[model samples]
Target: MNNNSSIDQSYTHLEIKIPLDPSANERLRSAVLSRLHELYGDPLPDAISDRVNAELDIFYNYFYSSLFLTYQKLVNCINGSGLPYYLFSSNGASLICYALGMTLVNPLPAHYRCASCRHTEFSNSADSSDCGLILPEKHCPLCGALMVSDGNDLPIEFFLGLRYDKTPYLALAVPHAMSDDAVSLLERSFSVTRKDPRDYKFPMEEGFIFAYLDIVPTDSDPESEMLWRSSSSAPSASSASLAPYEMTNARVFEYLSRPESFACYLPYRDDVQMIKSLLAADAVSVNNISDLSKICGLINSVNWFGFILPSLKSGAVDYRSTITCREDIFRTLVAHGLDSETSYRVMEMTRKGRAASILADNALRQQLLSHDISEDYLTSLVNIRYLPTRAHALELAMTVYRNASENVQG
Candidate 1:
């Protein structure tokens, strides 16, 4: 267990444990294999799966992703509250509290406890238990007016600062660069990167970054935009001082380079059914019964078969079954770009009526709707499920639709 003394004096311990779900490895592998086969028409050699799995295993074990995923899923589930997408950051949290106080609205459940104070309150009032939140209330008995929540209108900088705080985790930079970028003055520099922090794989711009940033600039902190972090452990540095738009553009550039990053956002719960349907369709496309028979054999076992060469249809295996085979799918959709026909098909197939799909379908539908998405882009998205999530696919569809719509209107 690792404990941090700085944040909580009460002593909070984070535990490390290996995932025992034997099925997770296979499920994850098959997920990847499905993408590879769809993209490249066959499973990658076992060596590649081994490499990717090693990276994935490490990421899967991190608390940040789990926490972020939980927060995202929860916020997406809320109804009719146009609270700008919830974000992580000391100040952003404050902004949310402020908005909650102003609107007398609660985005989270009544039972939700403050991560800092462990206080639970249904509405804004000082009499309520301290939720450890930065801004408890506008006129509360507890921590007073650095009272971040004024209800509703939070300064843009607050949200900007919040995303900046998450940069190290999602941005994955060289230690030397992180130091130069994250720390400005010499006084607190040693405190932030006391250990060999560069050796750790800190996440920066994963799928959530794109899904959220593409919609609400709340998640985006342009380095050029002067911003401040309220934390006392470090000297204040303005985001604008760091660079033009700061490191935001740089990180975004990095994320867009990897097609797989975009691909990862496609896994809405109902997407599994859509993919299964597509696979069945593709299976029929092969035409040669004997060839189809061989491909199915490989596809069915591709999740664990180790290596595959569509040219050879044979390979070695180092792990249990979970080989992915979705390369062709990505290649096809990405190549065609997002289109109206594909988007419509995707929305139709992944909708609520699908009984065979996962229960998480509603979440996926909500995510898609959040992005102002249309049908054609949805089709392109059904192909990129490696980093699949409810928000990412919908965002992509919306972006494509918005662009096309604007072009036509112009």
Candidate 2:
């Protein structure tokens, strides 16, 4: 059976209606066809058309679960015990926008500024149609810089197709530094991965950052019928602040210890050795993950994990299921490699857990006490360990001090 068979089964009962207008469907089909031809050849084959249609159907089918997994990864990277939030964008640099979007998390807005005139605009409009904000026709409002649609033009269409149900969230993915012109920002945003690799320059903000708030509907009707309602319909005073994540990409390092602790990477937990091998292999095509199992089976005498599962052999892992599982597995696996961290504090904390549990004998405590981490430090660390991220640690420490002070005063 597929690795995510258990997860898929639970959500199978919840059916969501996807309202597809014929005009919108046709436009999507045309765009897909054009895109396919651009990538392959002028003459598109019937097989290619069939495959594209199959992919689209799968994309629309598992929207909710995909969104959930995306949100979960962002939350884990940003809120883990040893990690910090800024690390997501600051270290992931501009790449966080793509990673977050690829994982189905809300993407931060990417902006481009005019070089000569310093005219700046959103890369994607909030309207969610094209998913990019372009300069007005050939004119930079600030410097009359002639607009040029170059390679750096944001990958808007790639993001638009991947969006979940429209939710109002603010993503500010500005790099800390940029050339006085828009071209540099574009270059920095979309350069070859090996050339720039996701490095965050000390004085730059050339990437996506996230801040999310609830877009609660005022009307009590079901979510499907609640269209055309303005976000401004609610009173501004009552709006809740969306929490912030520190912007950095170094957060990927925190995940390295995850494999040691959890026995498998959280992003690709099942059949992990194969997942890692696939990730390491550049020749492996992400377009079809089942082929990996097939190849594995062939090499292993044609009796791999799939052969062991009767359900999967009976068509349980259909195209829709594979897409859902593959997107999720790949998203998580990449995320494991993308987040950054200052140190492996969560692992240390887990050691502390084991010490406090059945191993709480005085001999064990004394053994742990021999380390640089003192008993008092360990106590404070344990208390503050529950705090969300490194950024919030200071506030939590202060709160602990204040609470102790108030008790003494009372």
TM-score against truth, every candidate: 0.18, 0.20
Candidate 2, position 328, lDDT: 24
lDDT of 1 by residue, 1-410 (tens): 00111111221111111223434434544544464344223344443334345434543443223333322333332212212121212222221222222111112211222223323233444432211122323332342222222121122222222123332111111112122332222112111222232234332543322111101111112221111111111222232122111122323333322332222222121222322443333322222111222233232221112223321322232111211222222223334553434433343332212312422367654545455544543433343222211111212222212212221211
- How close to the true structure is residue 258 of candidate 1, measured as C-alpha lDDT? 33
Q: What alpha-carbon RMSD in Å does predicted model 2 have with respect to the real structure?
A: 25.0
Give the per-residue lDDT digits (tens) of candidate 2, residues 1-410.
11122112211111111233334434444544564454334454443444445545543443322332233343342223211111111111111232222221122233343445434444444432211222224466666765432111222222222332223121111111211222232223322121221222222222322223111111112221111111111223111111111111122222221223211211112334433443343223222112322222211111223332333345444322221111222222233442212112222232233223422456544544553335753342333211111111112212112212221212
Global fold similarity of model 1 (TM-score): 0.18
Q: Against the true structure, whose TM-score is highest? A: 2
Instruction: In model 2, state the lDDT of residue 186.
Output: 25
